[model samples]
Target: MGFADTIPARLGNLSFRISLDMSNNSFHGYLPKEMSHLRQLKLDLSRNLLIGQILSALSNCSRLESLDLSYNQFSGYIPKQGIGNLTMLKKLYHIYLTWNNFSGAILASISNCSKLAAISLGHNKFSGQIPNSIISLCHNKFSGQISNSIGNLRCLAVIDLSANNLTSEFSSSELGLFTSPNRLHIFKNCGLKGNIPDSIGNLSNLVILGLGDNSWTGSIPTTIAEINLSSSFLRGPLAPEMGELKDLESLDLSNNQFSGKILSSIWRLESLDHLSLANNSLQESISDNL
Candidate 1:
């Protein structure tokens, strides 16, 4: 087997205009602090075997627009002086650092990066309440209620906070505040309770909704298209109004307490491709037309 190699410190001497992409490699060792010298617009070192904390010197790369260091073994708290200092890069927009061993509270200073449109920090060990300024954060150790401040992001379109330690009830008022969103996934047992809010109908652009594997009670909201609500405590008859979702493609309601015969209108969904209603009390026989 070939031995792993380290990034050369000499690379820092290269022209500041050179963008570097060293992803999906077997390179192992600490990221050389010398790399901070280059003022590239994009830097990608994801899917590697690198270790150690990110250098605070990276903050010096004033022209950086995109940075990706995901799928590495890098551990320790993200240097406040390192990432937080990037707010000066007025053009910086995207930052991806998922699937690392990063732990600690997400820096509050990140709120200053107002130009940032997307930052994926999922599958890490991050804790504490999510910063209101962030757009996407998932599969971490975060704990606290879904902040109402999230409603202020009127231009926001996508949000996935699944698989965290959030222990709050679903708030209808909070859901109603969002005016623009097409995808929302907050599932995989995040300790959420209460009914699926009727206010969910306010999201006219919503096409994909995943609220499964939580502690949800009450009936499913009838104003959705694609949906997943399996493994919850929801009961009662499947609403016949579900037939109104003519664009529905997938629906999963397994492992619930729903009882009653399957509605005949469900069989007429011309766009339906996937459907799962297993492990429920439904007494309907399969329709011959299906």
Candidate 2:
């Protein structure tokens, strides 16, 4: 039998992961609804001129784990059926739907993927408050404030939630995860204010803590013996207790109201790398046992 320009209907009989990839071949029209019968399958029809709404009938693949329908002239929202039978496939991970015109906030449906390690819904028109449960270390504004329970993810390594429309107070307690090896960067303009919490000292394993460009005021927490709090609007006198952080390599308290003599406790840091107390009104009198 010679190869024909059209997809052979007989190709469906493979009964196992049959990839009929004729995408972008100028194949105009609806996909054969019978294509859903393929068992143990992965379907890819992206980068095509295929036009029409995604079919909801493809939910028949009880064993289907992955699907790709990106980069096409397709219009309207994404098909939700491809995710209907995820109970059986324990190995399912990774789903990308980039360069499409999908819309709506699906906080309820995608939560079923409780075991997902990484998820991306970028380049689409998704909005509203991102669910607090589905996101532990990182999240964006689907709506609402940052979840108070976001501090539960103990295994999270890297977090990035810099750009969004959120409002709340970021406390040193939220940086509790720094006790582990993971680093954190929170550049929120979310009206965060008040004194620095002493809980940050618990992060013995933290490498970097980024809390710049916020409205935090008051005394620096003594627990944060090591960190850079420049341009954070951090005011008040430096507490002598902060020098207890022996692990601190650098301290940046420039442009703050830190006044009074330096605490005797600050001299305890054997691992201190740099200490910046510049541009502050302090009654500091440095002396040594000469």
Model 1 superposed RMSD (Cα) = 2.4
User: Whole-model Cα lDDT per candidate?
Assistant: 0.79, 0.54
Report the lDDT tens digits of candidate 2 across residue range 9-110: 565566776444544554445556666566666666656555565556555655555566556544555456644234433334434454555565544455
TM accuracy, model 2: 0.53
Q: Using lDDT, give the best candidate's number.
A: 1
**lDDT value, residue 183 of candidate 1:** 59
Per-candidate count of clashing residue pairs (backbone under 3 Å): 0, 6
Clashing pairs in 2: 128-142, 128-143, 129-142, 129-143, 130-142, 179-203
The residue-by-residue lDDT of candidate 1 on 122-178, one tens digit each, is: 888999988875555788888888776666655556677888888777667767556
Q: Estimate each model's TM-score.
A: 0.90, 0.53
Q: Model 1's lDDT to the true fold? A: 0.79
Candidate 1 — which pairs collide? none
Cα RMSD of predicted structure 2: 8.1
